[model samples]
Target: MDAWEPRPVPSVTPETEPFWSAAADGRLLVRECPDCGLVYHYPSALCPDCFADAEWREASGAGTVYSFAVQRHLGYWPEDDLPVVFAYVELKEGPRMVTNVVGCRPEDVEVGIPVEARFVPTDEGGIGVPVFVPTEP
Candidate 1:
């Protein structure tokens, strides 16, 4: 089998460009509805809840693991990165993202573990990808 290459670089659209820009500057941003005060990811034109116009807001970068899975093998990635823990983290402000849990072992993760966001440069385009790591009490 062929070895894993780098993931595809994300193309920035008008709506998502702000997110990528903020991430490059080491900030995590989420779109928030002014009417309902609901924050969400994957930037959209209208609010998911009230359909009101939303604005970008800085996130606190702190969350708790909602769920996770330890990937022991990859068909398209490098084996050296085995045991990658993929998690759904519920942000303190009110959004959940499917992000990788890094800087720790997969065996150590739990459903409610506290995590803090971190940005890492992507292999494809040097774009900042938001990841999470275990938070120290």
Candidate 2:
């Protein structure tokens, strides 16, 4: 999707309502478990652990690239398309989130490469999507 274009976010069930609402404000929100201080994505209303209700809050979005790979051949991603930098960012607070690495060329990504959140406005139907771009050098 074009960074400048807003498209509808295809899914928004009752459970995920709060997440979309926060994203609309240009905030990157994550679920935090009060019981264990755990944070995660794929928004959930309840903490999987301790059955504690989840709290919605802003995320620092600062993290490091845990691991990645260069796709030698893939039709889904165009030949000239930006390289996909999939990462599992381990938050300083305790949650590790799965997300794509953007803003930098794929070759620049490496294990432990530091990154911070830069939210992009996106629409997945009616739900707002908070896509991340790497912090500028």
Which candidate leads the pack in TM-score? 1
Query: Could you tell me every candidate's TM-score relative to the true structure?
Result: 0.88, 0.74
lDDT of 1 by residue, 23-116 (tens): 7677999999999988898778689999999999999999999999998987765567787888999999878999889889899899999999
Cα lDDT, all candidates = 0.82, 0.65
Q: Which window of ten consecutive residues has the lowest lDDT sum in model 1?
A: 1-10
Each candidate: RMSD:
3.7, 3.4
Q: In model 1, which residue pairs have backbone atoms overlapping below 3 Å? A: none
Error of 1 at 60 (Å): 0.6
* Candidate 2, 10-34: lDDT as tens digits: 3778888777766666666788888
